[model samples]
Target: MKGLIVRIAAAVVLGAAIVTGSPGVGMAADATALIRAAFDNWRANSSESTVTMTIHRPGWERHLTMKGWTQGHDKALARFTAPAKDAGNATLKLGKTTLIFNPKLNQVIKLPASMLAQSWMGSDFSYNDLSKAEDILTEYSHKIIGTGHAGGHTVYSIEALPKPGAPVVWGKQQVKVRDDGVLLQETFFDQDMRVVRQMTTDKVGRIGGRDYPVVVTMRPAAKKGQWTRLDTTAARFNVPIPAYVFTRSNLQNPRN
Candidate 1:
């Protein structure tokens, strides 16, 4: 009887452990699914957008208008269209490589790894930030840390940590995603766990039958009263884009 009671107790403990463990696993899977869905919503098969970027400094502000094209997350091209001085300047990203075309010099300069952290077009966003969409889902492990209400929507707070041996610069990233697949905010941290910068959606509305952030802002934590704002004026997603548009030649002499 003593032996039989001991065996029954062991079975009950095992059953409890299984019941508790299953929910944790399920939650993790659900979190990953949500994250992937959010990323997919923003970066469709192909997208074209016209945007205005405003760089605000303590002393002055500058605005630039640009047209951007993306073929999935691996390829993207952007060309400045306004502010005559900045017109004809273009940037292209293909996989891990990025190039910039200066219309004045009529030359294409490849961006080295050392220059990835430099500001792009004098904006708060870095070249690495521009190319992050291509590798974020693959290079980091994500976990849903908590949930809360923000901007009258249910938000999922997620933490992303770099995977072992991943060539990522951020030590961790905290993201706030809405239930409807809108990314509300993302905060980036350095290796020492210091806040580096943050990107937030200042406005969200319907665009092309999909909900998206129409106005987004990026600000560096170390800077005071300085921020870069991107306002999307027009956007079309899942449209076919020509292959040549992503080439280096197109970066210099854009067809459209």
Candidate 2:
């Protein structure tokens, strides 16, 4: 569950990819185009990102910093940079396998594919959700649920329910998309129709001729309990990432 939650927090930095020039594009059309654009862009670029999080739970408050690089849709490598306990720990994915590097143990453990369905720290996202980028429209059927104002921004509300037998983790998901197709917020519901997690993206900007968000925050849906908040401060796209960065063996055997 811890891994799932952590990845969900990581996803808050990733989930939004919009269509560039789809004026009058309905929710469905925009969603389809959004996924295609994200998939195409990720396929052509390698990038680096930095993430910070404040985890709050009963009588506990912790902060975490993570840095990593991503290549295409299937490769990524990230390591914790802060909080003495988690610092130096790493998660690396190369195609289908995910390896976790533990500095204290000086060892790497390969996680089973089936474990992807498990939650990250009892948080909203699943481990499988973190292993690769998702095509929201392609992976789930979206229905224009309604319109709403979220975080003081106008948004088109949509609900994505997975198709029968789909490799989905959430029972239902709500997304708030800006007029331009950027997803500004998302709420995930459990099988009991209760919200499990929520994410909000703020401070949108253009980097390298493409529109993107600079900060994204995620928290738990429940109000009474303490939840974690993750904020992304920097995201760089189309940069050079070492070819071996995302490999499991590379993480296990770091170069001097």
Candidate 3:
């Protein structure tokens, strides 16, 4: 009778463990799904927008205006349209390769991997940052680490760790997204888990029938009194983009 009672107790303990473990697994899966869904929400089939970027430094400030187009995460083009010095400057990304067009030099230079971390057009955003829209979902494993309230909406705080062998620079990334799929903040860390930089939504509003962050800011961790602010002036989603827009020829000679 004693042996039988011990066996029954063991079975009960095992059953309890299984019941408790399943929810934790399910929660993780749900968090990942939410992240992927948020990416899809932000990245439509095609998009076009006009923006103004302000680079703030301790001693100087400058503003740039540009138009941008993107078709999927792999293809994007941006052309500077304001400030005569930067006018006609453009950058194009096709797959893994990136090219920049300089009106002064009349040259289209392909950016190598070594230049990925450099600031784009002296803005706080790097060439790598512009191209990593899809990597947050594909190259990292995500888990919901905590929760908070922002602008009266519940936000999920997610931690993303790069998968083994993934071609990424950050050791980890922390993101906060609202329940309705709006990205509120994203923080990047170095390999040693030191905070490198962060981007945050400064203003949220309706754009192209979707709730989006119309104004965002990027600030490096060590660079006090310096930041770059991007404000969307206009936007259209799921619109038709001309094929030539993504080609090398169009980098300098853009056609309407």
Candidate 3 per-residue C-alpha lDDT over 161-253 given as tens digits, one digit per residue, 9 for 90 to 100 = 999999987899887767666667778899999999877778788887787666767789999998877777676778999899999999978
Off by over 4 Å in 1: 1-29
Which of the two candidates, 2 or 3, achieves a greater TM-score against the reference? 3
Q: TM-score each candidate.
A: 0.86, 0.76, 0.86
Against the true structure, candidate 2 reaches a TM-score of 0.76
lDDT order of candidates, best first?
3, 1, 2
Model 3 ranges off by over 4 Å = 1-29
lDDT of each: 0.65, 0.56, 0.65
Q: Count the backbone clashes (under 3 Å) in each candidate.
A: 0, 10, 0
Q: Candidates 1 and 2: which is better by lDDT?
A: 1
- Give candidate 3's root-mean-square deviation (CA, Å): 14.9
User: After best superposition, candidate 2 residue 247: deviation in angstroms?
Assistant: 1.1
Q: After superposition, how far is residue 243 of candidate 1 from its true place, in Å?
A: 1.4
Better of 2 and 3 by lDDT: 3
TM-score between model 3 and native? 0.86
lDDT of 1 by residue, 84-114 (tens): 9999988777887878899999999999977
